[model samples]
Target chain A: DTAVSQTPKYLVTQMGNDKSIKCEQNLGHDTMYWYKQDSKKFLKIMFSYNNKELIINETVPNRFSPKSPDKAHLNLHINSLELGDSAVYFCASSQRNIREAKNIQYFGAGTRLSVL
Target chain B: TQLLEQSPQFLSIQEGENLTVYCNSSSVFSSLQWYRQEPGEGPVLLVTVVTGGEVKKLKRLTFQFGDARKDSSLHITAAQPGDTGLYLCASPGYSSASKIIFGSGTRLSIRP
Candidate 1:
């Protein structure tokens, strides 16, 4: 079974269009994250939710919003997407250890979003 | 900001050749992780080193953490075509939160 899965493996939309990507994890992890990988292959953490509560919000713009309905699902919605929104969006989950602050993340295949 | 810098941004070598990639940082980290990402796929964690001056081995790949906990290295012996991927080094964010800071990554291409 795939531990982490993301829907819409590919997305192509025009500028100013809004889109959403869905992600689900079966690992029973407490924390889920949304990451953006640019064309340079630089991975950056955009948002993180632990047990359906927002924990980490990076320097991402307000256009990108992450919602976690439960511990197993975290979805990302982009409003009025622009050309700079083009990148591979990845969903990951981990069993967080607050004491140690270290965890192993399992990632999905990723959704490639291209904004024209 | 705490940053992880990986050396040899791009490497293309023939199969059977050994290679070593380095991840350095000025800030100390409690632990570090290594991940490999293949084309069209998300990164998969290979190993994690926690203690200073610690070393771990996975088949042909060996990972070492610096004594100061500020650097790490990954050495692959007799790299095969299957090993071709982008290797990234990451650490927990400076804050106590569960965020991870990933390095730029080293893109390795092994030709058969």
Candidate 2:
């Protein structure tokens, strides 16, 4: 069984179009995250949800929003996508422990979004 | 802001050659993690180091944490083609809980 899975392994859209990526994890983790990996291979945290509650909101544009209906799912919606939005979007989950401060993330195969 | 800097942004070597990659940060972290990402896939955690001057080994890979808790290193012996991937080091972001900040990554290509 795949621990973490995301839909639409590849997405090709035009500029100004809106798209959404769905993610699900069966690991029963408490925390889920959305990350953007640029061409340089730098993974930047966009948003994080801990047990359906928004926790970390980075400097991402408001066009991108994350929704977690429950502990197992976290989806990302991007409106008016631009050329800069062309990158691999990854969904990850982890069993979080704030006091111990150890987070080992399990990632999905990733969705490659191309904004033309 | 805490930053993890990885050395040798890109490396290409022949199979059977050993290599070592370093992850350094000026800020102290309670723990550090190492992940390897293959093409068209997300990163997978390989190991985590918590204590200062700690070392862990997994098969052919050896992970070492600095005495100051500000640096770490990953060494692979007799690297195979399967070892070709982008290796990243990460730590909990200083600004938020459960936020992991990753290094730029080292892209390793092993040619058979």
Candidate 3:
């Protein structure tokens, strides 16, 4: 079984269009994250949700929003997408244990978004 | 802002060669993690080191966490073509509102 999965593996859209990417994890993890990988291959965390609660929102533009209906699902919505929004989006989940200081995150295959 | 600088952003080596990728940071972390990512895929966690001066081995790959927890390294011995991928190092954020911070990433290509 795929531990983590993301939908819309490839998305190509025009400028100013709206799009969304869906992610799900079956690992029973409490934390889910959204990351963006730029052309330079630099991966940056965009948002994080733990048990459906928004815990982290990086300095991303307001047009980009993340919604988590439940702990197992997190979706990203982009409004008025710009050319700069073209990049690969990755979804990951991790189980946090109080006793351990570290948690291992499992990632999905990734969704490549292109805006022209 | 916490920054993880990975050295030798790109590496191309022949099969059966050895290579080392380094990840350094100015701030100390409680733990560190290494990941390998193939084309068109998300990164896969290779190892995690929590204790200072800890070393973990996975087959031909060796991962080390610095004594101060501010740095880490990944070394692969006798690399094969299957070893080609992008290597990344990351650490959990310092604040509760922050997420994990990833390095710039090192792309390794093992040519046959």
Candidate 4:
């Protein structure tokens, strides 16, 4: 589709449960990122991967882990989730990370996660 | 960590009205970008300002980068109902792109 795509557009689970959200990009970009949008609609960066290598890891909790198997795919895995984890999680990607270029990011439709 | 403070967290205006959203920061950025996000969707990039004091226009929307590269603004002229959405600003600093920071966002509602 030449866009960033994410699966499980909605998720509902209990506390202490584990879940995973998958992401893929057909834009041929090398860098992928995961962002969490809170209830306030604030988008915050969680993790970033470049060419299947982990690059940026924000001050996120250890329970939220992001794994990249290939350049086009990045997955988010959460262990022992809490109620505060409920939010809309988005996946994005970009071409280059160069300072001069500062490549623009393309985002997915987002996965709304709800924990009870 | 760099922080982007967006002004006027919420705004409601009638159609054809004008308003501006501001993003301010204490740290300099290599490039700043503006995005508009609708309900249930991810943010869509509107513009990217690379140079300090640079100005870019997209239709009725205009974006300006601060001369210090630490702030930015998005002004809309004759706004329409379709302009209602959450506007976010992001600043990805340096070559690593690790220090990227996003503004709190401006939620604008344009009534027709």
Q: Please give the CA lDDT of all the candidate structures.
A: 0.94, 0.93, 0.91, 0.90
Better of 1 and 3 by DockQ: 1
Question: What's the CA error at residue B63 for candidate 1, in Å?
Answer: 0.5
TM-score of chain A of 1: 0.96
DockQ of each model against the real complex? Answer: 0.69, 0.68, 0.62, 0.61
Model 1 agreement with the true structure over B1-22: per-residue lDDT tens digits: 5399998999999999999999
Ranking by lDDT: 1, 2, 3, 4
Ranking by DockQ: 1, 2, 3, 4
The candidate, 1 or 4, that scores higher on TM-score is: 1
Q: Candidate 3 clash total? A: 0
Worst 10 residues of 4 chain B by lDDT: B92-101
Candidate 3's C-alpha runs over 4 A off are A99-101, B95-98
lDDT of 2 by residue, B57-105 (tens): 9999999999999999999999999999999999965554678999989
State the lDDT at A76 in candidate 2.
Answer: 98
Q: Report the C-alpha lDDT of model 1 over A1-116, residue by residue, as the tens digit.
A: 99999999999999999899999999999999999999999999999999999999989999999999999999999999999999999999998886443588999999999999
Instruction: DockQ for candidate 4, please give it.
Output: 0.61
- Please report, as a residue range, the 10-residue window in candidate 3 chain A with the lowest summed lDDT: A95-104
lDDT of 3 by residue, B19-93 (tens): 999999998888888999999889998888899999999999999999999899999999999999999998865
Compared with the true structure, what per-residue lDDT tens digits does model 2 show for residues A29-110? 9999999999999999999999999998999999999999999999999999999999999999998876444677999999
By summed lDDT, the worst window of 10 consecutive residues in model 3 chain B runs over B91-100
Q: What TM-score does prediction 3 earn? A: 0.95
Off by over 4 Å in 4: none
Model 3 lDDT per residue over A1-116, tens place = 99999999999999999999999999898999999999999999999998899888889999999999999999999999999999999999987654334667789999999999
- Measured by lDDT, the strongest candidate is 1
